[model samples]
Target: MPTTEPARPAHHFVAGIGAGPANLSLAALGEDLLPGGLPLFERQPGPAWHPGLLGAHSRLQTSWVKDLVTLVDPRNRLSFLNYLVQTGRIYAFLNAQFDAIPRVEYARYLGWAASELGTVRYGTAIHEIRFADRFELVGADGPVATAEHLVLGLGTHPEVPPCLPPGGLPGVVLAERLDATLAGDSGATGGQVIVVGGGQTGAEAVLSLVRRGVRDIRWLGRRHWFAPLDDSPPANDFYRPAYQRFFHNLPDDVRHAYVGAQVLTSDGVSLETLQEIYRANYEGYLRDGRAPVMILPGRDVVRAGARDGVVTLWCRRASGGSERHTAHLVVLATGRRPAPLPLSAGLAELVELDGAGDPIVDHDYSIRWKHAPRHRIFVQNRGRLSHGLADPNLSLLPVRSAIILNTLLDRPAFTIRDEQVYTMWA
Candidate 1:
């Protein structure tokens, strides 16, 4: 069946390009402040924050207090706490005693907020955005809606390495499809499985295979060890507004160096997730006399291929040697790259690009464009170097959205009061 076109509002004050958590955060914050409202244009039929990757044991790395509106507007009606209260799940949620909320529960919280806002036009795909007196959001079907301002939150997608064959190998799959692919004769239970990447997704993928009775699994990562996320106070200060403010004022080289130095803080697996994996492996060993998962750190999978019933992976070890591993299925959890923005050629020509042909996002998250003064194009999750690791971190979602809102609204819509700060960045 074909996807039917949903009705658009004809026009909006701000036409958010994607309805992911970033734009959803914007809609949550700047909806009332804008003239008409910051409505979202989502390609998906419904609200789903990483629907495929929400494993049974996945938990958020950030705190629950870092919700859609709390850090920026705690009194906002669409807060996670408010969602809990309105849905009659507050007491039940509190009773669970979770150090970190389940990723599924956070997704549900986002969906609930999206439902309450009712500002998202789902199933509406924006392919190319062209600029005129205003911006026109063009969809696959046709030009859908025009807006005075545009915000890009296209979000990220699974990154399958180039070493893999085109369209992926026959039995090879991304980490998100591991479970379903396992059911399809991809050989999950009967043979060894290969999981690439050491991030949270890869960790979950390895654990999932163990749960599914896969006795042999090779978990490969480029790091010296499977590092855990540094969620400590000084480390978290790297996510604060004070740190961002200081970091932004530094030279580009310094900012880049700082981000490179602190990659694990934002990108590493959760400590709890690692502990679970170790405990599960220990239990499996006690029961079956053989550990289910083989944790191979310092191995980077540089090439992969599939033939007959086996998926072969050629990894480049950090200590400078190559090794091969053949498995029934290869799960590529190699992290995600940001989805390409739908900027038209004309719009692209107008926007300033960095040396690498990426957008030159400023301190305020606005892309430096020719018509930025009159018409603005703000982005989310596209600035890790310019901004810090907090550019894409969920813990700073509301704060980042608040910064963008303040830029878009041309006034301080939300006051970010980060007064009590002891650490001073040199």
Candidate 2:
């Protein structure tokens, strides 16, 4: 059994909070490079991935190749391939005929990888960050730990539409925690459901509720039809050496504009889930002579209200017209925004920011501060504007991990130490 080390003072090192995929990738990479390694803190009691939305039909938007560790170190023992082998699913997965596996399975894979790593502190919530001679992580229990480096992986938070009033009605709920919210609901069998937003999560929520035997459901979106994502396979030249050169040489404003254009907001449905939804809707339409589910496209929801278990929605039509509709349940699949960090007054004053309050990071993702020179504070998901299109996605986990690792080690090339490798697997 791996023993837990007591929290003690440490020298120059990196400390990661929130062990999501982004930070988990860094932790796995750090394991192979730093011995008696860095500390990772997670608020959850155990490894859980999007526990609020972990439905059976929920699947990943990207390929399985985009796992935590494989994108960086394919040969690492903690790779997804290794997880499949360890779980005795390698052969079964090969025969399953899936281009992308169910997201619940991927969540399980992440849990398995985290268990193997075994260096994270669970159930510890970091309250605030203080920058002194070094970075200090103050938690609910006081200063939990201090380090020379800090990486924030505090993922996105659910975004409730500003048009809707606070304190949701009895039947209205944001779709972030769909499963828990809808569980044990006898009313949902024949209840009407109105789902807002046109993103992948929105599509998944609609499909999930429909499959659970909801008779009446409607999907409303501003787009005429679902937009597909850029299906071009990994442009190795761009993501690799040549593209880095091009990106680095480009003007700052130009780089910002380019990334802004490719933002993945409601980017298409996965081929698997798309087929399932289309087929189900078509079959229902044929059987009943009318679709139980309605897809109202090219319309923006101007306002919404829920009272007495009925939701009244006011929509502005695409042709400059208006309409009103009502449903028993309303699901706001509006997606998420970046979680806010509670910075201390002193620390907040020192850190530089743009007009929008987003931090200014260098190529290594370190937040630039006026006072702190030796202590490097890095942000994981908060660099969308400066870091380009791959800011918060799983696609750039390995590359970002490499950049952070290089900065921590102060080395141009990251070479794995023998002791680090042994400690990681042991």
Listed in order, each prediction's TM-score against the native is 0.96, 0.89
Worst 10 residues of 1 by lDDT: 179-188
Task: Tell me the tens digit of each residue's lDDT in model 2 across 65-178.
Answer: 867766557887878889999999999999997776888888898888788888788998888888778878888977888777788888988877777777766677778666
Worst ten in a row by lDDT for model 2: 417-426
Model 2 error, position 382 (Å): 2.2
Q: Which stretches of candidate 1 lie over 4 Å from their true place?
A: 1-9, 185-187
- Count of clashing residue pairs in every prediction: 0, 0
- Backbone clash total for model 2 is 0
- On a 0 to 100 scale, what is the lDDT of residue 422 in model 2? 13
User: What lDDT does each candidate get?
Assistant: 0.87, 0.74
Q: Which pairs, if any, clash in model 2?
A: none
